[model samples]
Target: MTSTIGVTDRRALAAAQSSPPPRSSAASRRVTPPRDALSVEPSVVDELLLVCGVIGTTVSDTDTPDRIVPVADCLNWLQDLQRALRRDDDQYRPISLLMAQWKIVPQKLLPLVDSCRYDTDLVLTVAKILVILTKPLAESTERAGKLPIETKTKTTEA
Candidate 1:
């Protein structure tokens, strides 16, 4: 048995027949921002670092410039996380956790953090990154502390 469209089902059926639901003029092509800020949980640090690790691995690639979206997203995530941590005085543990990650992150993000670039906002973000998680590079003193064994040592003997 076939039933005609009921009063309530008319618009719904018309909407279903439409290829794409009509959107208001207000719905532009702009990307909307995230719904929520970074979570307050401390465990978010691990996931953040994981994203850093992925960025680090691909950062050396030749096409990295073309992949700006993900890099921007990761950087924004970092900033969001920093803001969350700073809100809680006693819970701000990024310094030590980031101290451990300094070896992995800064080197990868170095390209984006360059202060000489034209983007002052990037430079500002770089400064914030330094304040948040950047640490001094580890030096190679193992080789630096010793001179070449074969070469004559520079003696200070008088």
Candidate 2:
């Protein structure tokens, strides 16, 4: 069945079918700004470092070190821990080597309540990481069907 198009619908259809304004060569060839230039916030490296520090301090079962060496050392230790965790096959051999190299105790993997300056900072940093990791996934989801589309419906009174 054919439906009658209202004035609003006609106007919208006409606008959609009309040709867009022509652009000059200079306007068309204008250089777009770099993506980095649009960013108004600090880089994620600091947040990543903070997260590494938090995880490192917890794994080391020691107070946060005053020097940068300890922090770097802690980061290495965390990497080792991650590798160990992922080593499902040949677990014994890898764990033994990790234990020998870092002397890590899996039992003491818990973070103390007062380990970091603030728990919220860790939470926020972790959230930032999650956002970064899931950005592509989120974009794909949006492309799939999450994007909004404008539509018009007509009503008739008898």
Candidate 3:
């Protein structure tokens, strides 16, 4: 037996056959600003350093250093993570290293809060580092994904 289209089907077919709505003029289309035209926020850096400290603590059981040397030492490992977040570089080994370190002691990052007072731009650069450091590992839950991430407590000497 032959079946006829139902009222709903007819209406849907009619709608499909109908012409599309009027198009906006090309000039009316919205233009996206250039990358350089956009400004990065400062608060992101606070998040960045916090991520880095989490990564650092996760790596080798070292407490957050009052000085920049230890932090700088992490530069090589953190570079990849930085590039991933900052979109400025090609290498990601630094980030890989930071991940390796973080995998060792994942829980250690819970206490060190971000409380830095530097230029918003500078903090953003650092913030980029932190975001790249934690996100990938956070996405994984495999045994091979422990990521050197540790969760512990310690004290630093000045």
TM-scores vs. true structure, each candidate: 0.36, 0.21, 0.26
Q: Write the candidate numbers in order of decreasing TM-score.
A: 1, 3, 2
91: Cα error in model 3, Å:
17
Residues 26-70 of candidate 1 have per-residue lDDT tens digits of: 445333222122122344456545555543233334745522223
Superposition error at 16 for model 3 (Å) = 43
Candidate 1 displacement at residue 110 in angstroms = 2.6
Candidate 1 — which residues are off by over 4 angstroms? 1-42, 54-75, 84-95, 102-105, 133-158
- Angstrom error of the Cα, residue 54, model 3: value is 19
Each candidate's lDDT (Cα)?
0.43, 0.36, 0.41
Show the colliding residue pairs in model 1: none
Task: Using lDDT as the measure, name the better of candidate 1 and candidate 2.
Answer: 1
Tens digits of per-residue lDDT for model 2, 9-128: 878888978968677765574443333322212223233234344554323326754322234444344444454334412212222222323322332222321344355544344344
The TM-score of predicted model 3 comes to 0.26
| Candidate 1 overall lDDT versus native | 0.43
